[model samples]
Target: MFAILIKIKAMRVLRITFFLFINAFYANAQYDFEKYPSIEYKDYDWETVKSDDGVTHKVIVPDFYINSESLILKINYYTEEAKDSEIYISGIKYKEDIPYTPIGLSSLRIADVNGDGLKDIKIISYYMGNGLASLNVKVIYFFQQANGGFIKIAYEDKMGDNRLERDFDGDGNFEIITMKIQGHKNHNYWLFNIYNFVNGKIENVNSKENYPIMVQILNRETFKITSKLSRQEMKQYQVNNLENYNN
Candidate 1:
């Protein structure tokens, strides 16, 4: 009887030890940006600028491109009086590039879009061809402070005119919306993409078809499909007044 009791206690200890081992391994397995292969930190031209909110930012434009069609922007964050934190953002051109005309960073905007009290970064960059074949891209990086550094939690990209963020659900959080003019210039239609921050990341909450001129209501919890206008029905409505449209 004594021997059996001792063996049972030993088995219980082994089970608890195994459980802890698994949890420790998983905690360390999370993505580490420093060790990531696709990201590299090299010498680059750095500029220091102060935003309207009085925060100092060190913008680093990489001297060389790790990938030909992509541009990496490494920004260091600082207080109104001191320089201290860092955030890295990158944008890639989807379409084939036109040779000789390199893509460049055109503009940058710093603001708090998510209502999370942290300042976010918005980049507007363009690639030019011979006037007709040019492409303009916009990228937004949302920041979250973790582990003594500011990390990019969400990213949204659009190959269109401009990027807009609004509180679509009236829930205090912002939703990123982008409008892309598809098809040829003569018979083109607008394609709108909506993204919401959910589950610690950005998620698409719209269908792939054209939506009608109706209010889109998103469920704040699930982030699942609630309702949207179908492509077939959207064709019947005509949008004549552009100024009245909610961007």
Candidate 2:
């Protein structure tokens, strides 16, 4: 009896290596809001206009513009908050209004965001002074392509403050609730994504009718990805890396 057939083929190779390590731990398990909502609409609550009678921005592109004597607190990104708004830019890089500030204290908007009919460019900023988590915010988008091209989506947050719920769900479209990071900070986690502008670029229409706006942006994310998914500095937040995003 060849040693009982080598202990029954080593117990059938440990049950096929524990069933392939439980299917690779549920396929890299992490990013769960009922399995990370893909996309869904019908949750719009915007319209609080007080658009500072002077510089209600809409950055028209006559080769990159943001006039109104080069704006500076002409609020209108949903009635600016978390440090009002300030903008100034003229034909970027070649300089004009002179300022591309970020890292906190900002607000700039231009619609058609991912709808693909063109028109896009958003810049939002708040503050935590980036001491590595504890209420950080910085959402940036610059999607616009019809050949003139410009697709630069961005997201950041170590704790909270990340949203751009324009027409959040009321179906008119536009949904982006941030706070998504990935790997290598002790394996990060916490993600909720639903990027738009499909047929030209920017995808990941994560769907299932967006499980209640991904449970209301991860229960109004302020340190709730199941409490930082066992925080080791929340290195477990993940959204689909349309090539591992950020910056």
Candidate 3:
């Protein structure tokens, strides 16, 4: 009789614990959001700016591109002083803006690079030192789809000055346009590369200097490396109205 009574008590305790757990989860979820009361797409003014360590931040909303599949909004912003920065997104009628947790970024620009009608975000950050210094740390982060949430693609640390993304071969995917430096600003050149995503990894197909800065899509299963285009070469391409010569 004692054993049966003990079993009943254990069952009662388990039931109570389960009910408490569900109640707590629901309560927390309900209280997660603030009571803003209304939602609109208005630009937030510069929240803070100071000069002790020289911190500046500004946000501007550029254009809203509405396609048949998705609504792409471009956000342009910069931060001069702060350890952490945030970017917020919201719908035209929703009161809550979704804050994307940033990783290794301070300021950024969003645009549609390949004319695909999809927005890609680019971020640039400078490294902090002991005292004061002036240097630019540029990183190109591509936004891609994963499950239901969007993600930034480039994971390599500290990219260069300028970057362009396009389908270098005739394939339907995009690769990175990396500008490499030989020796600082004076002796550097640009190289356009072709990348292939295979086995869940980004790998380079073929990369060489002197390739045109233009967006060259893959065609007929291969892409050729053309002569390198200098900064002057880019000017000539533009002057002669040459297609696929330079960006």
Among these predictions, the greatest lDDT belongs to 2
Question: How well is each residue in 133-202 modelled by candidate 3, as lDDT tens digits?
Answer: 2222434344433322334333222243323344545344455444322222343332333344433344
RMSD of each: 19.5, 15.2, 24.8
User: Residue-wise lDDT of candidate 1 within 1-247, one digit each (tens)?
Assistant: 9999999999999999998998777555421111212211132343546565433223544222323223345443334221243344553221211111123443455555565644444544343433433543434354433221233432223344323455555554565565444432243334445555555565654442233222222232121222354556444543322211211
Taking all chains together, each candidate's TM-score versus the true structure is: 0.40, 0.30, 0.34
lDDT of 3 at 87: 38
Q: How many Å off is the CA of 200 in candidate 1?
A: 2.6
Candidate 3 achieves a global lDDT of: 0.37
Over 4 Å off, model 3:
1-108, 113-117, 127-136, 140-148, 154-163, 170-172, 179-201, 207-247
| Tens-place lDDT digits, model 2, residues 1-247 | 9999999999999999998998877556543333322333222122223434422333333323222233122223322242334332333221112112323334355666555455566665454454444355555565656654455555554443234443444454465545444443354434455555455445544453342122213222233344423433333233445432442
Q: Report residue 152 deviation for candidate 3 (angstroms).
A: 1.7
Between prediction 1 and prediction 3, the one with superior lDDT is 1
lDDT of 1 at 7: 100
* Candidate 2: Cα lDDT at 182: 47
Worst 10 residues of 2 by lDDT: 93-102
